[model samples]
Target: MELPEVVSRSEWLVARKKFLAEEKEFTRRRDELNANRRRLPMVLVEQDYVFTGPDGPVRLLDVFEGRLQLVVYHFMFAPEWDAGCPNCTWLSDDIGRLDGLHEMQTTYAAVSRAPYEKIAAYKEQRGWTFPWYSSAGTSFNYDFHVTLDESVLPLEYNYRTKAEWEALPSGGLVQGEQPFDLHGMSCFLRTGDAVHHTYSTYGRGTDSLGFSGTVIDLTALGRQEPWELPAGRIPAPDHHADGCH
Candidate 1:
């Protein structure tokens, strides 16, 4: 019924110093990993993907919206689905209020496997204004490894698992393809109009809840009890986005 607190000033200092020294290794490794991720090889996206926007059909490159760099979050909002994926919902909640990302010369948008009508309905329900697109008509999902017939994620390589090893299900029982949704943000840079697919992935699906920025949710403020906004209080447009319509 109570949390024990008996550490003295000296004890606290020693413990804090120990924690800092131990955690420094982890911090250093993470920073190095991030640096390596930024340096990852850039490959030309040969596939010309098309997605439905608020108005009409648009090319994926158009999502850049003339910015030198583009960051796309493959949100989960497929037509057959009842709602967006929970993990994606977490990211979208953050994506909605980032107006300053544009100041960095980077444009961020979200795309879902769901069709335009479904996405629009969802957006209206959630009150989200970020440009949400539908990639139901193209191989964009597959190309990004987020739309597969089986949930076992693809595109893997390791000295232990061969050059092209397939990912297994979250649990042991593998069923349907859960094609990779490219969770988090994938960054791309355009050099002289010849766009280059640069850095990608903020989540990368590696750690479910490790990214500091991605974690630390404040529940006392946001109405998440029923996973919906307060009634009669201008609910988010996409929160009500349902595929049935």
Candidate 2:
């Protein structure tokens, strides 16, 4: 089986030191990007959208829970679906106790297009305690661009319009995927009774937020290790039989 070249301790240390320098530079770049993101201008949220929460109908401002800042995860759970999106569920599983956000005066909640009953039942089944609300029959999802329906609004995903997305070779939402739902996170700032949309990230923008995803991204062989073949792709006979070589 093929493996990373074996090296003496000193040689390995030399390579490790080089990689560490790169990692440090990456951290600095990330810090700069974060600063710029924070400086982004926000838009006023003028819609009077209401979402169904555990306490019944709650306005968009009420979802903030009286916090100065709010982060809403646009979970993809259509009203027709029996459960939430698996990818969204995976990320939700990574969420830890959110009490820390309260300490920072930032509230966190999840909004989905599914009905309250389905969301409650599924949340109970998954043992999740975070605040999740239903956006059914409202423009909440459409305004946020999570639930895509050309009839309601233009088709856009991850800042890419329908034409732009179709022009991509193999990325973004393809044909026949319209009127669909995609997952993302949106940040909002509350000033008195006004709520403003500060920032939103979709696609891979939200991928690295999870601990498991971050760890995997740090490795030389990322989540795309060769042994992990795509569906229907046959592996070679001598390929690492258990994929643990």
Candidate 3:
């Protein structure tokens, strides 16, 4: 791998300080964006979606656990599949403990199309403490646009249709395939007896949830993804070639 040019400590500090200013500006911009996100209009969720849990049937409101806010990770675990998606499992591993989020009046859980038995067994095997539920009998996944029907040719993902996913040189399965399930996160807000869909993000938008990626971004390699590298920066030989989009 190509290394950065050798520089004196004083020269390094000058470059670091300039980059630090840019980082601060980025942080400020992110804060503004977050505020705007919070201000986005919310739509009331009319569907009475029910999910199966380890205990018994759970209503959409119950999934909030009486919290003011709910964050559901749409895990890709089909009913017939023996296990959950490896990518979803990787994200689950980065979720860490949720007591802090709970303390702030937010509850986090994972929802999948798999049956309760399948979800329970997989959850136990992964040693995850966060709640997971099965939306097998409900249209929860479909309503959220995280699950596509087999007939839907060009699957919509990340808010766009990718008609050539399977035909691409990278050769990846499309979401339109059988056992259709996709990864995403949806946020809901509870007001009185009503729940409102606040926001949802799919694909690369959920990358911020992985703390490891944030740490990696601090290094010279910067995610080791071609798109993330600065212009003219020589990427590592083993950098990922496939783009997340």
Candidate 4:
């Protein structure tokens, strides 16, 4: 790895202090943005979307497990695919357990279009303790804007329509094989047996939720994705890997 320029302890301290001030400002702004996010209006989920889990069929509210808030990661595992997306799996690796989230009155789970049997087997193989469900034979994925119909030209993703995606190629970031599912995250709130969709983010918006990426961001490498890093500070060619689809 290329090291940064060597500097005296005094010079390092000066730079660190300056950076700390900027960090504090960033933190404050982030907190304010979070407050605004919480204040966004929510839409009532009236559709009776049912998902299949290891325990059998379960409604959207049932996934909450009696919790007032629910966080669902829309895993990209199409019904015919043998496995889930590698990128989604990479994010899942950072999800250790649910005990902490549960204590905060939140329930978390991964939902996919794959069958329940496939989801169960994959979850066990990965040693995941959190609940995962199959939304196959339902419009849950489409309703949430995670999965798109192949017949619809120009895929809708990350809140962008197909035309917008095509305008900015970004090395085929939005282009890929047809009839495939995408990944996303959705948040919900339950009130007196009524469920409401509080928020949902797709594509890069969901990147910050993973612990592994946060750890990498703390380092000089900073994810090492092509889009990140300074022009001359890019990593060696061999270090690059095909990221999310």
Candidate 5:
């Protein structure tokens, strides 16, 4: 692909210095937050869960295999749905392409409450090659607070930060209580054949990790504005719900 035009040497150097300083500060802040996150306490997982793989039933701990880290995408596929959530599809499309960077040193997989046969068929239909398995006959999905009888709204006070959530219904993903379907990157460390589920994040509802939205926001930023819909985009939640249609 053709690249954008480069700046003059002097201008490029100045820009580089500014960018490097900003990046260094961002890196420092990120490391500090991660340190705090790492120090957060973990809850006891009392349930012994198992999942269905191509081979057969595999214990939850066995999913990590030899990899030191395992990130599970709690895909939005429940027993009643004929298809996965479109938002999840949007995210998973990116994931399928990302699963194979040789140097990343991380393993990515997906677990859903749907049965293996059903889940496998869906993956095949989507032509997705990423690791996906079924959580049928297990409490793992529920334990992860991604599945249950009724929809969960994070019960604590929801903070609005991300653009999509802005002007969405005022009631937000409450910080501490919603047992909703969580989109998360779970990190793990493996030992022998047993792996420990190390860390996960819930509400404040995940912010942009700098691939798509954040960079776009930084350029044509609007989440800070009146939270209006983009010029050509669809109407906001409030407008639609208040009978604007």
Candidate 6:
């Protein structure tokens, strides 16, 4: 197996120091980017999207759980699918107690296109405690562009159209794949009775939030997705929503 060159302790320290400098620079740039992201404008959420939860049907505002901010995981579980997307489950497995988020006046939840019964069954099967809801028979998924149906809404994913995606070499999947649900994270802010859409990210944009994905990213092999450079490091799995698309 290939590995990094082994060297003397002193030599390794020098190389580590050089890498540390680069890492620090990257951290600074990332801090600036985070600041810019926080400053991005938010949109007013006018649509009254309702979701079915364990307790029963609830409006979008109710999903916030009276929190000032809401972070939603657009889980990829189509209405017809018996189970959630494997890739989405991969990320969901990393979700632990979110008391920290709650303390910060934020509520985290997962929304899927599957029926509440299916979502509840899967959630229990995986032993997940985080709130999961169903957007079945609602436009919540369609409005968020997570559930793609050209007949209902124009095709758009990760801020790109079908044509835009097809133009890319790795975008062939989008050509034939339609009326499919994709995974994403969307943030919303509640001010009194009004809910504002703060931010939404899809595809690789969600990588950072996935603890498992983030840890895998730090390894030599990376996430083993097709888009990663030095390709064919390993056989990429058939990932539905969260993987490269």
Best by lDDT: 6
lDDT per prediction? 0.61, 0.81, 0.81, 0.82, 0.59, 0.84
| Cα-based TM-score, every candidate | 0.69, 0.87, 0.84, 0.89, 0.62, 0.90
Predicted structure 5: lDDT: 0.59
Model 5 residue 3 CA deviation (Å) reads 24
Candidate that would win on TM-score: 6
Candidate 3 residue 196 C-alpha distance from true site, Å: 0.6
Question: Roughly what TM-score does model 1 have, to 2 decimal places?
Answer: 0.69
Ranking by TM-score: 6, 4, 2, 3, 1, 5
**Model 6 clash pairs?**
none
Question: After superposing candidate 5, which stretches have Cα over 4 Å from the reference?
Answer: 1-24, 41-46, 96-105, 150-169, 172-182, 203-210, 221-245
Model 1 per-residue lDDT tens digits across residues 164-238: 222332222212444433344456787755667775443334233224333433332342434345433674422
RMSD over all Cα atoms, model 2: 6.7
Report the error of model 6 at residue 64, Å. Answer: 0.6
Per-residue lDDT of model 5, residues 1-245, tens digit only? 22335779999889779889988999999999889977876554445678898889887676765455677877767665677766566556554364453246567788887778878888888888878878877767655655533343222212223344544665433233323344444556555555566776443133332244354555534443344455447864433211000
- Please give the range of 10 consecutive residues that has the lowest summed lDDT in model 3: 236-245
Estimate, for each residue in 107-212, the C-alpha lDDT of model 2 and write its tens digit. 9999999999999999999999989999998998888888888999998777778787666654445334556887889999999999999999886677755777
Ranking by lDDT: 6, 4, 2, 3, 1, 5
For all the candidates, what are their Cα RMSDs to the real structure? 9.8, 6.7, 4.2, 3.8, 8.1, 3.6
Those runs of model 3 whose alpha carbons end farther than 4 Å from true positions after fitting are 150-155, 162-176, 225-245
- For 1-245, candidate 3 gives per-residue lDDT tens digits of 55578899999999989989999999999999999999999999999988999889999999999999999999888888899987788778888889999999999999999999999999999899999999998878877878876563445555555555444554554523454777889999999879999999887667777787778767876665545667475855323221212
Report the CA-based lDDT of candidate 4 relative to the real structure: 0.82
Give per-residue CA lDDT, model 4, range 44-111, as digits (tens): 99998999988788999899999999999999998888888998999998998688889999999999
lDDT at residue 67 of model 1 (Cα atoms): 76
